[model samples]
Target: MPPMPARIIHTSIARDWREVYAFMADHEKMPLWASGLSAGLTREGEEWLAPGPLGNARVRFSPDNDYGVVDHLVTLADGQQVHNALRVVPNGDGAEVMFTLLRLPGMSDAQFAEDAAWVEKDLASLKSILESSKA
Candidate 1:
């Protein structure tokens, strides 16, 4: 299949990249910033279970690493799996957190735009929380 269109939604936080990575990599803390996971996640073996838009979802996050990669796979109740690529990179004294949102198959342009906006809002929340924490 052809590659789906993608948008990189990101925000800059006035915090160390490693610190930001540590906070985001912890899936349990995601609901504080990631609105999609506002209901929070519960560990179930190697995967996590969360109340998703389409019912329950199984989430498997990447293992801990030196790099700031916090990628994860979310399996919907309908058996649809979505791969999310997220990263926190150093930007001078601050960090830039980015989330790649792919326009999935059969997704309308308006739906894709809305998804991008949602991601943007989440990233903004992350930036606010992290940056404010330093004060």
Candidate 2:
């Protein structure tokens, strides 16, 4: 069988890179950008809990860093661990946010495309919020 593909979705945010990264890294602000985390998050020990299709799942975000990397590992209620890749990079005076979506083993092309579209919409939401706040 062919391997699952890794796809990236990105958007230009009209905010300072540092500001964008800081907001993106904060779990509390995720509901403002990431729909998958819309139900909100709470930290417990080393992990964070959020609502998803699998119910309340434990997520451990990578420790804060200076290089703009914002990766996270989500542990599903049923024991599946999914690694989600995300990043923010400087773009002139603003920033560009990118989200990497992985196509799981059993997912079909259609399903993968759907996920990609979802990421695009989520990024747009992020862009809208960050950019509008500056206006």
Candidate 3:
């Protein structure tokens, strides 16, 4: 199968870049926008576990300061596992978010679409929260 296409979403936040970056990097604030991510645990290294509404999964963060990339292993309640990579790039005033979901051998196209939608929604929510908090 062809490599999964990356979905890109852009939104402007009124807050400064530092505030926006801090909020985005804060794993504890994920549940505010990320669906199914009920809680997150951060380790000293780049590895972390984000508990979904169904089950827990592992995440790996890329070692980069200018750009942020996260690899997510999501386990569905039915025991299905999906791997996805989320990348964030800071725009001049806001940010640009990208999600590259790796499709399993037997995964359907609809599943990829659904995951992309979820990521876009999460980004939108993040933009809303950051912009609304502007002083």
Candidate 4:
């Protein structure tokens, strides 16, 4: 299969990389910044169930680690799994958070652009929340 087009949407935060990672590593806190999970997530065993575009979706997050990685796989109702790659790394005294978005099969140019814009907006939301919070 051919590689899908990808976009690395990111934002800079005026906070320590470790601090940013710590805040984002908590799955339950996603709803605070992630509009996609604005309806919130419910933990069921190891996976989390969140309201999807179509229906409830199961989300499996990457295990905790010293390195900053907040990857997750969202399983849609139709069993389509979308893998989201997120990372936090040092940017001088601040931090840089990045999210990789892929243009899936059958997606149109307009749809892909919209998805990228959504990711950019979400990252901005995250930056706002973290930057405004007390360290």
Kindly give the number of clashing pairs for every candidate.
0, 0, 0, 0
Give a tens-digit lDDT track for model 2, residues 1-135: 475589888999879999999988878899888898889999899899998886898989989999899899988888888888899999999998988898888889999999999899999999998888852
Best candidate per lDDT, number?
1
TM-score of model 2 relative to the true fold? 0.92
**Candidate 3 global lDDT:** 0.63
Superior candidate under TM-score, 2 versus 3: 2
Q: Model 3 clash pairs? A: none
What's the CA error at residue 22 for candidate 4, in Å?
0.8
Ranked candidates, highest lDDT first: 1, 4, 2, 3
Q: How are the candidates ranked when ordered by TM-score, highest leading?
A: 1, 4, 2, 3
**Model 1: how far is 34 from its true place, Å?**
0.5
lDDT of 4: 0.92
lDDT of 3 by residue, 1-59 (tens): 57755555455556565566666666667678776564656564656776666566666
Candidate 2 segments exceeding 4 Å error: 1-3
Model 4 lDDT tens row, 1-135: 699999989899999999999999988899988889989999999999999679999999999988899999999999998999999999999999999999999999999999998889888988998899863
Error of 2 at 107 (Å): 0.5
- Which sections of candidate 1 miss by over 4 Å? none
